[model samples]
Target: MTHFDVMRRLTGPLAALMVVALAGCSAGSREGDPIPAPSTSSTAPTPSTVPAVPPAPTVAPTATLPPPPLDPLTPRPSGANTPKVVNVTGTVTAGVESGCLLLEGYLLVNAPTSLVYEGVRVKATLEVRPDLVSTCQQGTPAMITSAQRL
Candidate 1:
């Protein structure tokens, strides 16, 4: 068969592929450059022929997050005359004091039953009882005197 016949068959399909590739890359072109139509005079695009499309202003991917919540470890001044009352607010996880705040269907420490589940928001009055709290958790320990779900 003649070489021209082979090239004619290949060019028809190859030109269609170029049209699709150019469409994806057209986003970076000038305001009024005419998209070249499929023709034998123009060479099929190579990687270099397609102007570099300085990738979609590569937005460094971000994660979904809430505004920073109240820190459970904020410090406050202590005076001998002042009562030790801690107003701690945080997500109450399944582990309270690292242990489930409930046992056998009973909520311990007067922790509201409705709020006993994990990840419940709580604002509670923690009475200072340093002796009963273990310092290993990197925070002070106190009894839950009262709590309100926020």
Candidate 2:
């Protein structure tokens, strides 16, 4: 064949192959690549470009009963006289300081070791004893006369 005839035949096939290869590469890149965000003069991000976040689920309000009154009683003049006592019923919880127990804001004192555990509901007879020295560092100190799990 003449030089011109050979050149023309080669160019047509080579151009068609190049176009096919470029189309395939462009399609793959379009699928894999993330779209570039539009540039803005303002530093603040555009609201449209930001993703929408779902709102948190609403929780129901819990009803809380008021804590019982813990008024201190008058100290007995003599050991022969009986001290005043009040009954308190509530759940036992751990104090912020270690080895301390509390019931309805009353620092439990003179309670049995077995009953000093946390989270146990109990019916207890307490005597407000503000005169006694305490190291529990929390709640009104009350002496437990009798206690039983409820």
Candidate 3:
């Protein structure tokens, strides 16, 4: 027989012998053998023997007051129909975004073309409009109600 045929003949017997040897190694308690009890130490208690702890009591949530605004502008009187107008005095500077002007951290909207130039010192009256949509991302959005060069 060729070497390949010889190998094929031995492969089945070799595999069967290996399986039998592995089965013998894995064999544990035989028939009629008494089962061994679980080992225990007196120093440490078993999980089932330990007593359960009582759960913590639940707490009711309390109402909290809202925080005050951070802006320095005067607070509006309670129940006012109009937003509070604020006066800002500072040099008008170009914002990081194009077509945006800032004065004292307030982005100027509807500002006159003359007052929109950079480095122009001006006194401007503004109404803070947090609801207004703006492309000036660097400062708070405020509408320029009035402005004058100083």
> Per-residue lDDT for 32-136 in model 1, tens only?
658754455857698887887675665765987754432334433464334466567666654344554532222333355675556677777766544333423
The most accurate candidate by lDDT is 3
The ten-residue window of minimal lDDT in model 1 covers 102-111
CA lDDT of each prediction against the hidden true structure? 0.56, 0.78, 0.80
- Between candidates 2 and 3, the TM-score winner: 3
lDDT of 3: 0.80
lDDT for each residue of candidate 3 in 3-51, tens digit (9 for 90 to 100)? 9999999999999999998996677556665864445656777899899
The TM-score leader among the candidates is: 3
* Local accuracy of candidate 2 as per-residue lDDT tens digits, 21-132: 9996676434346764446568876999889999999998799875444333434446533555789889999888888899998888766778657999999999777655
Model 3, residue 136: C-alpha shift (Å):
1.5
> Alpha-carbon error at 3 in model 2, in Å?
99
Candidate 2 clash pair list: none
Q: Which stretches of candidate 2 lie over 4 Å from their true place?
A: 1-83
Which one wins by lDDT: 1 or 3? 3
Model 2 TM-score? 0.45
TM values, all candidates: 0.31, 0.45, 0.46
